[model samples]
Target: MEQIQEAYDALAIEFAASNPKSKAAYDIATKCLPGGNTRTVLFYEPFPLYTERAEGCHLWDVDGHKYVDLLGEYTAGLYGHSNPVILKAIQEALKRGLSFGSHHADEARLAQLIRDRFSGIELVRFTNSGTEATLMALAAAKIFTDRSKIMVFEGGYHGGGFLFKSGPHPVNVPHQFLMAQYNDTASVDELIAANGEDIAAIIVEPMIGSGGCIPGTPGFLAHLREKATEIGAVLIFDEVMTSRLYSGGGVQSELGITPDLTTLGKYIGGGMSFGAFGGKADIMSTYDPRATSTARKGASVPHAGTFNNNVLTMAAGSAGLENVFSPDVARTLHGRGDDLRNKLNSIAKGTILKVTGCGSIMNIRFIATPPEDIHNVRDLEGQSTLLLDMLHLYMLGQGFYMARRGFIALSLELTATELDGFLEAAQGFLRKYATLVSG
Candidate 1:
């Protein structure tokens, strides 16, 4: 353990020295930006690498070092960086206009595209971020049901909204949100039975994203849907990260469990910031301005944003969906993810490291058996964060980028040769780290 930590420390020093410009930038950023970074996702120990530019599946850092991108901006770049299709669309949209407070044709076009793919979505509303989309979904559910409480899975991250973040302290939450176990129907039943009447909805990520790339069991999801229907609570599927797993947003095509509402983002934005929520016609009609005149909030549910359907994002999103919707393209991306998972598992077969996930998302666990089957956030208690961090640093030093939480998202641009390189590098790292586990 000590040796591994020392090796990582040395690598950190080398990383810092190799990128003088990024190091200087980090130092300057610390003066104004807390933690020397604007977003928590970009903060890496010993400072993060500053990218000069990215093309296809590769990223060139400020130091001129190139690496095959596996992080994909936390799974937001499924089509890869600077994709020609997406780029051309964005350029065209820019020529027309950037933002229009009024509704644009592209917004409806994108919404129609999404609706066509996911069966549960009858009407869609756009938001600037997944966080806002989720917040709006929750608010709409509450208003429609006249219920204040919501049920959320422990590891499920809908967004950074106060309601979603209401767990153990430091989140400073003030709402009626209940935390339930993931993949355990009994736990959800318990919560619903205790507070079903007051609960407006149950929101969950079909595949846990930031909590680790764990997928919800089919049985568990079915149970959740049944319970939600029985109790008259909305079932919200947050497919922001898992949308890349299938052509049709995750739950619809992958799990086949339909929800009352679905929130989407990540790759749908085509490397831009965009999010959306939609649901059944009757439920979604609660927000229709034309229908609800003279009622409570004067129709429309008071959900509006200046940049809700920015032209650039809409164009990029449409182009991104074009790539994802192609059967061959979706198969290729999913194949790469499968190859990665299999290769990692083969490497760690007899070792302490355990690889777990589904389709295009995966995680590495230091323990032999991941606690609680990793169905939810509470199951993360036994995970080896220190060991994972060391392994992450090791991988970064060897020229691979991964989410700090060990999530790896593959892109359509990567070829077999690039994929093999990642597997080989990861095998080498695991072999080296196995010595520490044995000691």
Candidate 2:
């Protein structure tokens, strides 16, 4: 552990020295933006690199250092930095207008594209972000079921306000939350047995995104579906990140377990800020303003957002989905991601380094004697994050950009050669830190 700390300190010093411009930028930013960041996930010790420009799968930082970008803007940049189709669509939309303050044709077109992709989503309502989508989904569920309690996993993260890392955060919306364990049907069953009557919704991430990229076991997810039905609770699948794993429907289609509501965001907006939530017609119909009985209690749920159907997001999302990131493209990316993860595991065969995730998104962790299948974040307890921090700096020095927390999200513009380059850099890091990474 002392040796590892020594190595991490050395790497940190090197990082600080190399990215002086970014350090200066951070120093200046701290005067305005709290903690020198608007997004919490992007910050790291010393400072985070400020990208001046990006093209394809590469980023040039303020210090003029070039790197292969694997962060993918935390899965929102799936089409890469500059997709010609998306850019053209945005340009065309700009000519028409920015904010129409009314409905447009592209909004419905984009919604239709989403509905076609996910069978579970019958009616779609857009929001500015994934956070808003999840909040609205919870609201819709509570209204539809006429219950107040929401069931969530211990490590699950829906949005900023819906977080449940250890427990419901103080900043979280005051929904009566019931905590359960991810990938553990027994824990869910126990919770349902206690509060089934008051539970309005069961929200889960098919693949836990920020909570260590852990995937919910097939049986566990199926059990939730069964339990939700038995107790009359609305099942909401938060597929904000997992939707990119499959080409046709999503993780739901992949596992053949459909939920009552599915919240979506990230790449679906073609790199523009966007979100959507939809599900069973009966439940989603609660938001239908056309209903005649407005006077009746709970007849309709009013949902309004200023930029829900903004022209830029609708246009870019439609063009990217239709032309760039088609079903064939999605499938290809999934295969490549699997192959990459397999090779990564192969390279780190005897080391403490292990990777976990579904397709196109993965995370690195230094776990001694890691389990064959990581079902949840609890399975990764006591692992040293210091090793990941060291590796992050080492990879950055090797001209590769990834999240400081060891996250890597692939983009459509990233080529096989770029991936190969990343693998080689990873191999170099392992060899360089053989003493520290050895099991």
- Per-candidate local distance difference test: 0.77, 0.89
TM-score of 2: 0.98
Model 2 spans with C-alpha error above 4 angstroms: 293-299
TM-score per candidate: 0.94, 0.98
Candidate 2 lDDT by residue in tens digits, 1-439: 8999999899999999999999999999999999999999889986899889999899999999999999898889999999889999999999998899999999999999999888688888999999999999998888878899999998899988988877789989999999999998888988888999999999999988888888888898899999999999999999998888868367987788999999999999999999999998878887889776432355577899999999999999999888887788888998888888888988998998998887888888999746466787778887889999998899999999999888888999999899999999999999998988887
How displaced is residue 202 in candidate 1, in Å? 0.7
Q: What C-alpha root-mean-square deviation, in Å, does candidate 2 show against the real structure? A: 1.4
For residues 60-121, write the lDDT of model 1, one tens digit per residue: 88778888888877777888887888999999998887777777888888898888778778
| Model 1 CA deviation exceeding 4 Å by range | 162-169, 292-298, 370-372
Candidate 1 weakest ten by summed lDDT: 163-172
